[model samples]
Target: MSNPAQPDHYSGLLQGIGQRLHSARQQAAQTVNTLLVQTYWHIGQHIVEFEQGGNEKADYGSGLLDRLSKDLTALHGKGFSRSNVFYMRKLYLSFQNSETLSHKLSWSHYFEILKADDPLEISFYTRQAALENWSVRELKRQMKSLLFHRLALSKDKQGVLQLASQGHELQQPEDLLKEPFVLEFLNIPQSHVLTETQLEQKLIDHLQQFILELGKGFAFIARQYRMSIGGKHFYADLLFYHRILKCFVVIDLKRGAIDHQDIGQMNLYLNYFAKEENVEGDNQPVGIILGAYKDHFLVEYATASITNNILLAKYLLYLPDKDVLRRQLEKLLLAEQWDEPLAESDSNE
Candidate 1:
């Protein structure tokens, strides 16, 4: 026993015991969750096997799940609604191998993913959820935002397949780009007039969600990052250092379409960062001009001459129409068959 009057000894003992208790509680909760997930998977497997056994009496209709749900709730008290039992059946169908199921994801995560009809989309969400440890809420948000389609739109067929298989990989500067970056989380109405400053402030206010939308490897560095050139001052709208890319990413926000001057300014910022700000062993900085819209022809011609790793992208105030995006993605996938193979063969030649 320690004297209460001796604050140091008492505090140390209290903290040590508190930490141990917290850790133990976490371990216990994780064990219970893991067991629950495994048990649900087994139940799904059993249901599927029983259905396949040619039991016409049980296959009398969709009544099987309803009856099962009632019996389970009557016995176990909760957590087995008709919908939940249906998802369990889907869980067995979607991922037949119990060993392939992720222990990290809860049943809620699987439920959200199982709702997706596309196998590729399901696989992408599954891999991304497990890799990023996304909460059920986060998973729902991403699914609604059509994160897979957004990332896949820029990729060729092979790239799309890789995304479905490996999840988002931040290997280079281009890997970090997402066109029409969804900022619906900012909650600003598109009809409302917005200034560059107001948008920046709202982004800072929702910094956590903004960082999530920015994807992995981004670490916030500064806002309105100042730079000097020839006794004149310029401020970048947002500055981020990508931990994985090992470079600074300067973003300039535009309330409207990006102009030629915007391109020139971002190039200047990248040049300054590469020469003055970047320390040894740091890679060349990347610049992004994020605006409401841009003319593709104008951007292509403007950036074609400049050598800096500058990217131009749009930001939407509301969630994009997923159906429209899916159609566009389908077009890209279809075009890849005729385009990518030719390009690859040319490169080899």
Candidate 2:
């Protein structure tokens, strides 16, 4: 065989060249994206300015958008359609703070975030999209899945405002939980009977989407984490390490209605983790039970005395009813006495 040094040198050279080229291309792309977003901002600023002038041109300035779309499409050939122009105008209005804008995200990212009715939400999603480096498609998926509302189930109005300002920080036990995770991406039909093994396998197969749904900083550790207590053996369903929480997160899935047994089992798992698995510097582990039907009373009673961080939340195989869920989530947050000094859990995924 040839000298190993020759191959090693060539491999190193190849990697170095590849890295430099990739970085250069990324820089060029960022430059182009920054310019494009700035251009759209200017276009939107001009449109808003024109609209505010009260020119009395026509009903709702409808003709202005049509005329602009036609002329700009003729000039730019792409990205200046009537709908796009409207989005541009919205982007300007939604975030008047130039400080909130990022060169990392494209105009498309802003377009999707504008769908949020709340200004704080728009700001939150924009920051999160940039911070997460989420693609346009991923950003849209999170927004459509109602990630904000899911998190909102635990946070009050001030907490909601904090979420907008800081994004979801996984500090508290409540912060670790996101209610009613939407798993529509798994392609499991509502009619399809899914076993625990099948559900775990599906989540593994779609790990990327699963992690995104789990929110920030959750890194999958083991599928069925094993722990033996005395002569008996137990396996936690799915285990993850939350980098932000600096603690282990255990998930137990239930296909049917969850009762006291589910909570007890999860509590056992959490105790095992805190006692056996936890090393120095790590915080107490948290457990979550995602069942088809959640009995809040059962969960509250089961977890009342147990100090281990645990939550019982509902899960839907199919997409959730956004309006109904939004109202329900709002009610949950509003009902809570959230006046305590709130500390959102910090995480990065």
lDDT of each: 0.86, 0.81
Ten residues in sequence with the least summed lDDT for candidate 2? 340-349
Q: Candidates' TM-scores? A: 0.91, 0.89
User: Model 1 over residues 1-349: C-alpha lDDT tens digits?
Assistant: 7555778878888999999999999888778777887888888888988878975223313889879989999999899988888888788778878888887888888889999988899889999999989999999999999999889876789999999988888888888777569999988887998999999999999999999998888899999888888999999999999988999999899999999899999999999999999998899999989999888778889999899999888889999998778777776776687673333332111
Give lDDT tens digits, candidate 2, residues 1-349: 6666787789999999999999999999899988888888878788878878985232224888888889999987988877788778887787676556788898888888887887767878888888788999999988887877777766677788888888876667788666788889999878899998999899899998889888888899989888999889899889999988889999998888998988888888988888898999999998989888876557768889998888877788877678875666555554455534323221100
Stretches > 4 Å off in candidate 1: 1-5, 56-61, 338-349
Give the clash count for model 2.
Answer: 6
Once fitted onto the true fold, the runs of candidate 2 whose alpha carbons sit more than 4 angstroms away are: 1-7, 56-61, 329-349
Worst 10 residues of 1 by lDDT: 340-349
